[model samples]
Target chain A: MSSDILNQLKDVVLEFDIENAEAVAKKAVEAGVSPLKAAAALTGAIREVGDKFGKGEFFLPDLVCAAEVLKKALPVINSAIEKNGEKANKSLGKVIIGTVYGDVHSIGKGMVATLLYVAGFEVIDLGINVKGEDFLNAIKENNPDILAMSALLTTTAAEQKNVVEGLKKEGIRDNVKVIVGGSPINQEFADSIGADGYGATAPEGVKIAKKLLGIS
Target chain B: MQKGFKRKFEPIKILSSSQIEQIHSASLQVLEEVGFRYDSDKALKLLQSNGCAVDYETKIAKIPPDLIEESIIKTPSSFMVRSRDPEKSIRLGGNTLYFMNSAGARYCDVDTGIVTMPTLEQNNEGVIVSDALDTVNVFPSYTPYFEIKGVPPVMSCPVSCAQRMRFSTKPSRGAQPTDTFIWETQMAQAVDAQLMGCVEGAAPLSLAEDACNAAFYYLDAGFPIYIASGSIMGGSHPITVAGASVSHNAELLAIVVLLQCIRPGCGIIANNFVSAMNMATGDLNFGTVAVALHQMAYNQIWHSLYKIPINNTGSAFSNSKKIDYQTAAEKLPLAMCSALSGANLIVLHGGVTGELAYNPILAVIDDDVASTIGRIVEGFDINDATLDIDTIKEVGSTGTFLSTKQTRTLWKTEDYMPRVFDKTSYQEWLAGGQKTVIEKAKERMIDILANHKPRPLADEQDREINKILSEATKYYKKKGLI
Candidate 1:
């Protein structure tokens, strides 16, 4: 039984299957497998992916795929811990992430994603070409600790406000902290966009996320 | 301060959108009726297809305004001007401002200090790569200011430039091969084997009658040619500030129209510098206030006319000392005005002194200042949130605003904190180094040079560079460059 649980944790770490990570996780839970060990295994793998990104050994598609793979494994890994009465009911924190509309670029968002992961926060990325409604939904759904968005194009920076206004229309204003980022973006634009925080670089983004979450 | 701004300068006009439109219309009129002369036949063909009247006799093309505007929109507002030698490249039109030094030719000032007609060591070969890499904002071969070290050729040839770098012994001899159209029969290849390209400064040469014969050369061994035009008002331009700006604008406009006549999307920089030639001595004086105004006007007009991102030469001082009122006045206004005018670059900062006589230094303060100055130019956007009137009233204007969330948000993002000028009490100043900005800058220089590890070059490339610098060493030994 012990070996079976370990094997399931390993498979999840390997990202061998979409449903299998969750299914095997459930099986491990039934067998009374340790939740922390399971989490440690996946976190270790994800950390490797993150490091590889930092080292330039991996590209954007690899990052997106890895993020997706991690996404698949997270719930399963969490559910197993919940079953064992060690549920991560308290998350490190939450983040609402999106690409400002009109900007098809996603690398900045991806950097923020990896940074949030390394810093131990749950980030809900709304993906590229996302409009204000999408942000509203993510904020409403996740009730995240920080709302983050990025736009690479100068023309699309205006869309950042549209997202903020969208949040207002939905009556969820001021409930979540918004942090804005991108290449052309400055503190001025971020403030103008009504975001709570502005980070110039990816590392700074992590710092902002942690600070916003009251996580020091 | 904002209201008093007009009192000082009569409020230099910020051209309204309509005024911009008028300028564009005027430029188009110049292109179509006044006509631009071209050196290359291919450039002429490109212009003719795009609604330009091509006159083979003068190698000139007159383009319509709408067409030029259409072509301008296609030009990449942002681009990475790659360095073949330097491992890093700087992005033009990116929010980041790149820097280069004040590299125009040095002639005897006659008044303050004699410029002593600078030679190869003091000019192009000695200046190129180190000058490009020492600061930032990618510098093109200041065509005339090509090298500080020895290189074989500075002709309109790519192989020649590369060959020179490969043969030089200097630590920083390199070139990013750019396409330039020579006579109708020959063209310099692009640095990359795969891409055909051109830089903007070569416009004047490419838009001439000689370019016709070079056509077959480009067609066969063709590399993309980019042309750029530069005008230094006092040195080679009109004496009046506005007059100088107008001359440069006319030159740039003429050149681009010529290049567009040849190749529609040819990259260019509305690159121009307005330097004050000490009226008495004729030395390049950067601190003169008129040059700042000239640069500001030139940058704004170019942006308004082209809509293409511009790379303007900004702030530089001719003094050997890195910090002074000359440095302060010249560097500050040049940087600020360029930023306000949205210049993609301001090249001479950090370790640049004697009008760029010194390149390497131990201090990084200049670099720090340059970086801070760039961020300062980005400026603040004031809206309801920035005003935070409610927050202000609740906290009370007289009370401390430091503890507010807005303050916290702003303080974190503040790009500059002026430190060289001591603002502390006299006692505090005594406690620290009782030094002025120049002494502080010198100390900072020591710190940077002591800490930096120059980006390394490939062994083969290094060998080529060494061999070339050795030749320069010999040349200098004969001529005493060091």
Candidate 2:
């Protein structure tokens, strides 16, 4: 019976049925299946989705929708696990991300946030036109493991350096790793700005985030 | 005012006749059953009055097959776009092929590949270089850069249009992201020019109010319309090429029905900018074989079946960050496919990094590519002036024809001499510093900038453009968009 419920959870994610994911998660909980087992099933299914994406069998929208299904189902499973007096392994790490000041471009930052969430990271997106003070405040409040900044315009790209400088001035530079990315950014820019890493694309950004957190 | 290439031979067709009918029937069925949403109340009313089943609340318009067929017949097969200089006017239909300048949001340095927000001076320089290139017959909407430094986002379109009018006399297209088409029309009228008004559709069967409004305003001003529905496969559209063709066709046809109903016999050119999605990276796979196939199929359908003028944007960009061999390899196949398959206007020069950057040096190199493709589509005359028999008898097998009258008179016309390609001997190349194509392109760009000057606007026309720009600034400010 537990196996049936777990399979149902996995099938829902694989099929990208966001509407039924939470209901299926609730069903698995009521069936007395371990929330950990159900969560593992979802992770496995999303990994399969990733594999299909890599193989070109599935596409970006399919990957995104499947990740959304996982996102919708995980909260229900985590809440049930908490009710059972258990800790849920819900996140690889916490990441705070945003597009820097004076740049209203959000597509790159938004894609990185979604990919990180799908990769088992808890992402808190600060949204576009984010100021350095807001980054500092969010870091102080959320105490995230990594900070990611995106600046699509060359004029606003300097804001990445300013944010890094602000972190140093606030004396929290050593607490969190910094990752920068965008069209105008490269390894040289990242190294000059004292950033920990640079990602040329969104998938690369997620991989760098994992490496910075010492996770797989 | 360049005489664009004409395809003397029959165009290449990819889809069978039955397959073309299947896609067309599928689009008609989708239009009737699935329906499309028009956000404008005026469009819904107009569509409903024209026998479409429109739900005002949902804004869905289900057009019938007959209405679509009748509209297709009503659309003009060809039309003329007038330029400031009458010599630069172009006809966008039939076998005539024209190349338009591609657009990007930022300017890339020729040597460094660093992209930055373009200043107004840099934008003018891009337009000047485009004007100097004979292969660039028309200018696309948002020509060199989408956004210029020190210009308000709300005013970028009008500002870009005004700059294009000032720098080049070529016919330009107008965009309406922030209601800039109103000012664009006025600026065009100020210079006695015409702007190809753009009416773009949102993907997955929807038309926004801004686009609908632009169509009405442009038609009222006696200008032709360019309709496009840019979609990504596996995202807003189906993944299969045929399925994407059906969906893209239905989206553009919805606008076609709307336009023909409003003004019968109006000129319209449907544009195909559909791109395949990179599933692994979740980015657009620009200049891919899938996109080229889609364009080839689209060109055949639009040209042979629908008898409509079509524009292909599949070669407008590349996924590569810099101008390299990857950029050329990725861009050329789609361009050649589009040309051979009968695209009326192709957006080809200066775009890089998938619409993120532009470089004038790249445009200079693309001129050679465009000329070569144009020469191929132009084909050659078979009826010989002398049958070459008399000339062959005059010069025996051992005699040299290099110095013959036939060679001297027809040498320049017989073959295309590329402006930037190196044709020197190996030792000569080594002696001349072994300059690569990029270096040669840079040198050519510098020469054009220094020597080639586009026709300047008259004082009265210049003052009128400035006055219209000032009025647009105030208008956007009043609307809180500036």
Candidate 3:
């Protein structure tokens, strides 16, 4: 019976049935399935969706929808795991993301955040027009493994360098890997600003993030 | 005037006759029931006199359907805009198609991708480049950059008009933002040229006072008016294309009624610049399928149904920052769709980064795109001699037609040779350093800048333009805007 519920949970995520993801997760918990097992099913389902996206069988909206379903199911599983006095499921890493200061552009940053979450990274989005001080504060509070910055305007792209300098001044630059992206950003700008990497697009950013942490 | 491309075939129709009538009726209902706000007292008085139900306090003019149809009929089907050089004047209706230079706020570097405020010299170069391109027939208002170095905001329009007049003989459009049209009128008169007066509308069925005043001024000057009301889908307009089309059509028709009432038989080109909102980012999504459908539907209703000239500004820019595959992928489809469906003038060339910047190199590359679209719409001839059955039989079986006189005489007219796009073999491309289209565009831009010289203004006309610009500078300085 537990296997059945777990399989149902996986099916909901794979089907991108975001409406029923929470209910299925609850049923798995009530069926006495381990929260770890439920979480594993969701993660496996999302991985398959990601693989389908890679193979061009699924599109961007499908990937985003599947990730949204995983997002809905994971909280119930994680809370249950907490009640059982167990650690939550493993993540690739935690990433702090936002559009840099003076730039309110959000699609590229939002896409990066969604893709990172689908790649199994726990993401804390700071939203748009984020200042260097705010990024620094989020870094200190979250202690995330990565800091990703996005700026769409050439006028505002300088703020990415400011955030990097703020990290260096706080003496925590080594604590997290930094990846910068946006329309105005390129590899040369990333190198000049001492960034760990630059993504020409959102999918490439995911690959660079994984490589920076030496993850497969 | 240059003979623009003619669509030998019927325009592509996206809406059934009943659907077109449905949209038209809905638009009339919105105009009659919801009523469009005309902020100017003169406009209100004029509408009230023309049998439109007007509320002076609310500034809403509820136009009746008969009056709307009558006003649309009063507008001329086509009109000529005179340029300093007679050869550059362009007709703005019928089956003919023309290209206009797009506008941007800043200038982008071709190699480094850095954007900055354009200098006056760079702005002049942009105009000259547009003037030299074969496909660009008209200069849109604020043709290269909106802001140039050392020019205050209020004076930018007049200065840009002066630069366009001095550098290029093409017919230019006029803009109104704080009495600049007054000076633009004087400058155009100084050169014996005509300006396509721009009277734009604010979205959600409203016309601001400045735009209304510009209409009065341009009408008094006897220049044709270009009307546009650019809106965002799901924000300022309805989310669905069908719903948005009703609102967009209603907004434009309101202006048409006002212009026709102000001056009957005036030339007008209704522009459809509506764009979709990127729901995720809250920015304008240009060159999307939604925008293309909107333009196509707008073209059908205005061109085939109302018999009015139309312009499409949806192809002007892209969300992509650089001249990459994304830029082309975004721009070309909407442009082609506009050409196939009935557009008299298309706003294309140089616009990039969602109207944030313009690059002359990008304009050089877009020249190729514009020419290709022009050639496609100007469909091939289908006559007996051109069919060349005799030549085909003469070169029967294993023989080639490469040496035929028909092939030699007709290949140039039959095919479009792009100015910047590469169509070389792999070995030839490698031998030539495999330069991409952007590199080829850079070389072309340099060549034009070095070789191309636009018709110079006569000494008296140059002095007259200088005198008018000085008067504008002094007028704005007294207003503390300079």
Candidate 4:
């Protein structure tokens, strides 16, 4: 790719250039770049930002800015991809997520939701301490994909099972994939309670979701 | 080196302003409106027949002193709580002391406070830190369920004990009174009766009176009972130091009274902290106020009255990294207070975040520090050997005391001998990778877990211990608590 196209593509991911994505797309076209190559360039930029943030070279503020830049850049990139109709990461399906009952903590569930959004999946965040029936109601209403449950406190971790059991009670156990995460929980606990998958943190949850989704 | 006696007795510490009131209120409430739940139908019937208001729906019963007096009278005074290991028996009464770790630290800091991750590494580090402290007799904190659940959940409590228990035998090592696999230690304790408390159905002081009563019931069973009263500064009691302290002491005292009543002079542990929550939010400080307010004052008062031992959230409860300034700032005072106040058992040496967590080498560092702290409290005799005035007077005119016999005799003992500290020069330190104390501590942990062979259990003893735990676990399984 030409320098101008590369710069625009880099800005798309680093600066969350979704708003500028159309201009970046035009630049890519001007440089005779295929949508596939331009998309690869965007993914590569995100990876670099993630690496820098992980290494402390970039911090949370940097991450927010970068994500915003990507947000701004996505439409232009998406239009180009749409025009070309190149097959990239489509939806890894949809995920309905929330913290279990009697728990107001949101960080654990929030992280998982953010990661899901970033990893090219649709996420519906249901807020905190959702009752057992609520999860089932959402799943039935949305008819999306996976059901992700989170609980940071030990007292609340038990509620994850209640949600899963609620699904069973509602006669929709096998209809959706199930996953659990939190501070006090472990994989064995998830298994014992019959959860389909477990993750220690949000990023890990995304990875687990991918595995659960059979997303290669 | 001569193993001399180190006396740590805190006598001046009395209840803080809030502590006095919280207990008074809690007691009045207990006696009046908010009665207790009695699981046993027989116990319930006894209470109901004796003018107690029984709520069958809630399984709660409130009784008068007249009805409780008989049951209270039947409870023994001066029961021994035995350690699973025959060698770990301890007598609980009068000036006797036992220590335990500070527990359930808050997750996030309010202002400049930083939140932390609860990991296995942090938990083990806490045990190591406690063993490293000088005055601490016991180290109890995090649920090392990770290691215990897999490796030897059977030895979960035991391994936690072993983390710091193997240190100098001068102080008896005590473990948490967990329901899981702890009966092994209790059975083994039949020999000496040294182990301590169990969860009183959720709250710290929940079963203090009953536990002490039960242990005393089995007094003839050959175990000393230490009635330990625990209070969560912000959660269970109050957020302020004064309020938390009062609640903690009052509850501990009530339980202590029961122990004393059961066995005239029984062991009592008063556990408290000045844990304050940023009320606008729910954030709480676990350590800063713990040492400054609660432990310091507690050890002083308890020592003066009954030679009582004190349990506290020590340096391990700090909200900082490793043995940095924060750890020293939070821990040193608590240790000194224990030493000076004569607290028989000062727990949570290298512990962190109010003993809800730990750092491994910190354990060794704490142990090394307590040696110095122990010495500070011990003071010294102006004897001929210690004074060395003649030698000093002669050498004063010249130079070094290196050649002197007095120096040769005492120098080694004078310093705080570190189990995992590097005292080498900068150049040598560089040669050794210029590691801080934490690095050395981590190394020690790996060595201990890998090289050390924990003392094993005997056949009959182990069998009986397992039987007890299995029986208890069965009850829990039935209740779905496990």
Among the numbered candidates, top lDDT falls to 3
**Candidate 1, B1-482: lDDT as tens digits:** 00000111121346666755655565566566767776666767767877788887887777676766665665656544434443444445534455543343332231243334445543323333333233443333332243323333333233333332332212111222322233111111222221223333333223434333333333244333333444454566667775555445555666555545454555444555557677677666664577777776666666555655565554644443433455555566666676666566554543234343433221233454565655565566678878889877866733334334465346545445543444443433454657665556445444434454444446765555445445444554565533
True contacts kept of 1: 0.00
Model 2, span B317-408: residue lDDT tens: 99888889888998999999999999999999999889899988889999999999999999887667535777788768544354244654
TM-score of chain B of each: 0.64, 0.98, 0.99, 0.69
lDDT of 3 by residue, B1-482 (tens): 98889888889999999999999999999999999999999999999999999999999999999999999899988999998899999899999999999988999876666789999999999998988898888988787999999988888899899999988989999997788889998899889989999999999999998899999999899999999998999999999999999999999999999999999999999999999999999999999999999999999999998889999999999988878888899999999999999999999999998888999888899899999999999999989868989889986863335434465457778889797899754434665899999999989988999999998999999999889989998998999987
Please give the fraction of native interface contacts (Cα pairs under 8 Å between A and B) kept by each candidate.
Answer: 0.00, 0.00, 0.00, 0.00
* Ten contiguous residues with the weakest lDDT in model 4 chain A: A59-68
TM-score of each: 0.49, 0.69, 0.69, 0.51
DockQ of each: 0.01, 0.00, 0.01, 0.00
For model 2, name the residue pairs that clash.
Answer: B1-B88
The residue-by-residue lDDT of candidate 4 on B1-482, one tens digit each, is 11223543334445664654454455435533555544445444545665777777765655454433333344333234434343434443334444443443322222233535444444554444443343444434233222432333434454444333333222232333433324424543533334454323224334432443344443333333444444455677766555555455545544444343334544444444444444566655544545456666655544443345554444336655334768777677666565555555555444555444444445566656766665665555667898878878865853335434565456555655566678654434655788877678677667766554544444564465556555665665676655
For model 1, what is the error of residue B40's alpha carbon versus the real structure, in angstroms, after optimal superposition?
Answer: 4.1
Using DockQ as the yardstick, the better of models 1 and 4 is 1
Model 4 residue runs over 4 Å out of place are A1-216, B1-5, B8-136, B139-147, B151-186, B189-194, B199-222, B233-235, B238-242, B260-265, B314-316, B321-324, B354-356, B449-451, B463-482
Model 1 DockQ, alpha carbons vs. true complex:
0.01
Interface RMSD of each: 19.0, 26.3, 21.9, 26.7
Evaluate all candidate structures by whole-model CA lDDT and list the values in order. 0.54, 0.89, 0.90, 0.55
